[model samples]
Target: MVATRAQLIWIPSSGVGHLVSAVEIAKLLVERDDRLSITLLVLNPPRASKSNPFAELLASVSSSTASAAKSQIRFQELPYEDDPSGLGAKSNMSLAERHKPQVRAAVAELTRALDSPPLAGFIIDMFCTPMIDVANEFGVPSYMFFTCSAAFLGFMFHVLALQDDEGKDLSEFKDSDAKLDIPTLVNPLPAKVFPTVVLDEEHRVWFLGAARRFRETKGIVINSFEKLEPNALKSLLGDDKIPPVYPVGPILNLEVTGRSDKSSEILSWLDAQPSSSVVFLCFGSVGSFHDDQVNQIAHGLEKSGHRFLLSLRRPPPTGMLRAYPEEYENLAKVLPEGFLERTSERGKVIGWAPQVEVLAHPSVGGFVTHCGWNSTLESLWFGVPIAAWPLYAEQQFNAFMMVVEHGMAVEVKMDYRNDLGMETKEIVDSEVIEKAVQKLMKADGHDEKKEKVRQMSERSREALAEGDSSHLAIGRFIGDVFKNIP
Candidate 1:
């Protein structure tokens, strides 16, 4: 029987990245199936930015679509009446503990709001697996949305499966200089390039909890494509510990909404440059530098003699990860003496640039990026190679995946750690930054690398089109819901 209507609720972990990624896949899901509707039930997170990612998603969902199916998408933010987990006040609670009460509250509220058409399934990021049990209370199937690459997900599951006698835990491996034998990876991963979670005991425990909880979900959805990580996806499926895995990704390449008015100067500057001559620098949302480091980066850009646009901000506040908008300051005060004047014609320094517009421009030949997954995919989508400078979290691992696994980027600093809002032991020298910029921008050594990335760019676009692997995987997932979700 044809289903009259079906609703799916997707709960992303509390962050701009998680929310935006969920919105991407949820939009595609509804577009492919007219019988489907999705509701993004967001829990309140602590900090807010002027360029909030959720606002961008909301705008796109409301206005940018050319299809009639866009109306099937719905959005709601559930306000927690009682602080069952005290998530409102910032504490050191694990992510699982932090999301439980809010997830239950959202579920309860949504249940009460619906009259006839009930939920089909709940889609959640791996960080919010605590919400899976809430789905059981309503007899709804829960699915896992793995936001990271398949290689990282496979390595994590391998670590979680290892027993006391099998090998030492990830924390013990931290002190050693050994490369892990993750069977899923094409090359062994060095301990220095591992994600930040395994290095800390508390975060390691939290990861283990999330990893083990995957087995309880109905299925898993990864934000990656088949040709991108074939072997790792194969390994993920071969393992009995994980549920049926679906590869549906390169999702962050969707249309960006809510770009600020400040981007016009940057885009106009880029358009005036010769095609494939300018390089753009955009670290992740929170990636910024200390004054000395910013000085070094400025010196480097001046020496490169290439047209460039850089998106930079002041450092984040104490005990916070995301940065808030700062009062406008003089560029000369933060950079080296005569730096702005020396490169004034070739370089434009803005407080924040519209990253999607800059990346899409024909003049942008390369990117100097912090290899957050979103930035990495965006560069690939635009066929712009990167000089990878990873700061924290799984970003170091992402850098490895880009340089070693995909050969799409050059490595600048895969092991740089300067995110405690403090001074670093040693600053990356001006010459080092200059060399990497030149290599990615105008060097003859990167032609083959650029060609390969261009090929992958075609693949990235094809994966989301009709009759492609990612599109088919999403279709199959919807079919599974129709078959199993009662």
Candidate 2:
């Protein structure tokens, strides 16, 4: 008798960040269990072009997997169809909901194929929860792959319970001085740090609906290690109504591939800097600033008198939605006049940084980040303390957690939201930026936040080792998957 291979279907949201995380988790799953295989149902949103980062990354992964002699991982591109509902292209939630029919068709075909292995379960992205109905049709269990922090997950559940069970209107809390008593955070969560979507009526409804659907899943696989978020994970596991929680992560794809000459140049520049002297300022792919804000940052860096590398980007053209920042044609146009000349010996401004490479460098002492969970984890992994400057999404919450809950970061501005079309009234002036950067890059090398980050860095690696927290969580998750397979 031969061992039966179980197949799992992964449906990640259409964003490049989400896809990268899902791919990393899928790779981890297959490498751990030879009897398991994964097929990713790739989604392409409207107006996605070859230049899109998601497409480029998918092509790269496919090419690498194709070269392997016996690869268990495969990619299945879903047929593209414009969302009949005009709202689908507006947000990730609407876009995922529009793919329900396509997902159903793909699962039906996969189940019908004679050569396909036994279907195990559906692992859907946090935004793609609408596909849970299709999993039910096939009599398979569905699990959610949350790409954010465990504390944020707890916040979502709390929001759902507050709205449904307690009939509390969350919008009233906006702009108020009230502090929320969420179980995940040791301190009360301030109203200002609430995600912007929660305040908007339309987006809030959609987000809460997704949170409600999360309860239908068998479990949630969070991309965070246990030691990094013990209090939040403990609160989640203690809740009986919530499904089983899996904390198996720091699932980073550290391989440096398809490096451009610009990346090499950036690395070489870091090599010449003094040890623990450079402060790196690189936001996420979509993070950018207006000319005025850029000027403020420039003055701040100049006044700090610190060695710096700034990854500045131009915002997308007018009327373009869901677009990444573009490279500026000339740095002189947006930068402060003669600013580059003044800081010539101490600073370098560039676009499209190789973030992991820069963080891994020995000379980088601190990070001024957008507080995206992936960037936060990378900073922790490299033992570099962060100046938390959140831009959008759940980043504000992540910043709050790091600065207030974990005491591992210096707060630049936790509640900043760069919403498109809105005036950025709360500009972080040069003075605040200068003070934050100085505090973050203090030369004492004995800052408590830095020490805490260094300690978490070691524990993050330990969690993934044999018999540790993350490793055991992975084992338990795989065991549960096998148990559910008929």
Candidate 3:
């Protein structure tokens, strides 16, 4: 074969899930062999200091796990202003039409930063397809990473097509049972469970613009295994509008360093607990909570009497937690009286967590999640039953897949509504949250969900082993997409 020559750039969307998934793929490229040189282009949040905690953590993790491929992996940070809210800052102001301009500006700045050298290809996040035109201008291939499963992809793409052809909007489909005739989907999902991007009419219109841009990518890669979504994979491969679909996943398994010492400490705590006794709660990197919702959630967890771990941030105004409306002490006062005292011994409320390590802990029998794809995979990898609470993006679809289709999770909200404020818009009350957590830990039918996840964990592990399907796909990607360029 010709000597390989390629340089790959990864531009991830905002959120830990996307970043983790992208990093894992980058690691895979380097681990396959030495000929691959990769540039990891991460945008710096305008407000965060040079010593950003998440970035530092990522650097540390990458350094440890990437020894074999260290020299080949390069890190570059570009100043990005995705929103003027100054990274990690949440605002109640709605700027629907204006959001695109800032996104385009960020992409332009990224493209301008890449002016020095031409590479064989660029791997952009699915949400960053505005960079496709830039990739084309530079005569480079732009592969799109969906950052989700094949079934979820099918649902999203199908919704986009409907908007293009039929002018269908979420308002028309809300709470309605419509048969989505997409191939490989196998079943029709309730529109309520679709991504919030297509939830409202204006949002649906906005999505069409983004979807149009996303469709321009040269190829699409998903973080999913073939056995998990075979039919959806087939549909993606069959679609003439898109390039071939590669199901290479359970991406976390690619890590060689495993969990850190702090992570192990938490795991140790879990190990001492009874099997299936702990409930692990984690929203995505960005949090969305209101004060009332937070109080209610706290009360619900306390009442349930289950040992829990709550990873939370202040939600937006009319937000989930009381932290936004009052002083820290005042916010603390909002929890049900005596709730903290009673549960303090059984609870850990850390600001951040080593999620994968926690999930893999034997004591962690259940997960309360925002239903983000990476979290879903991590939980599945550990055979942890999920209590699904989808907030934004493709989370709703993921929740549906886990709870409804796959039967590996339970939906926290059966009748939740969020027509009021951004923070509370999709909020499920704490009572439901409590019930879901209980069900996940121990319920009449929970064994079935637990068993399914256990089975999924086995498959996830198998897919990452040598000569396995995901492993083979990674090798192929290196050959076709990354290797032999210059």
Clashes of each: 0, 0, 15
User: Which predicted model would earn the best TM-score?
Assistant: 2
Candidate 1's TM-score: 0.91
lDDT of every model, 2 decimals: 0.76, 0.85, 0.66
CA deviation > 4 Å runs, candidate 2? 1-3, 48-51, 65-69, 83-90, 318-321, 420-423
Model 1's C-alpha root-mean-square deviation from the true structure amounts to: 3.1
Ranking by TM-score: 2, 1, 3
What TM-score goes with each of the models?
Answer: 0.91, 0.96, 0.83
Worst 10 residues of 1 by lDDT: 84-93
Model 2 TM-score (2 dp): 0.96
46-135 per-residue lDDT for model 3 (tens digits)? 333322355665676567645756667766655544444433212111121223344345444544664323366778776666656656
Residues 170-197, candidate 2: write the lDDT tens digits: 9887778889999888899998888877
Ranking by lDDT: 2, 1, 3
**Local accuracy of candidate 1 as per-residue lDDT tens digits, 1-486:** 757778888887665666778877887888777888877776655444444444545555545542535567766765633333322112212444556667677667766774535678899877777778878877889999988888888988877777323776667766468887786798888887877667767567766777778889889999899988999998988988678888998998456545556777677788789888888888866677778898889888888888888777876555455444342378779888887788888888888767878889999989998888877788888888889998866888889888887787887887776543322367888898899988897557449889888988999999988899998999989888877667
User: Which parts of model 1 have CA positions greater than 4 angstroms off?
Assistant: 48-70, 80-102, 112-115, 163-167, 256-260, 322-328, 419-424, 443-446
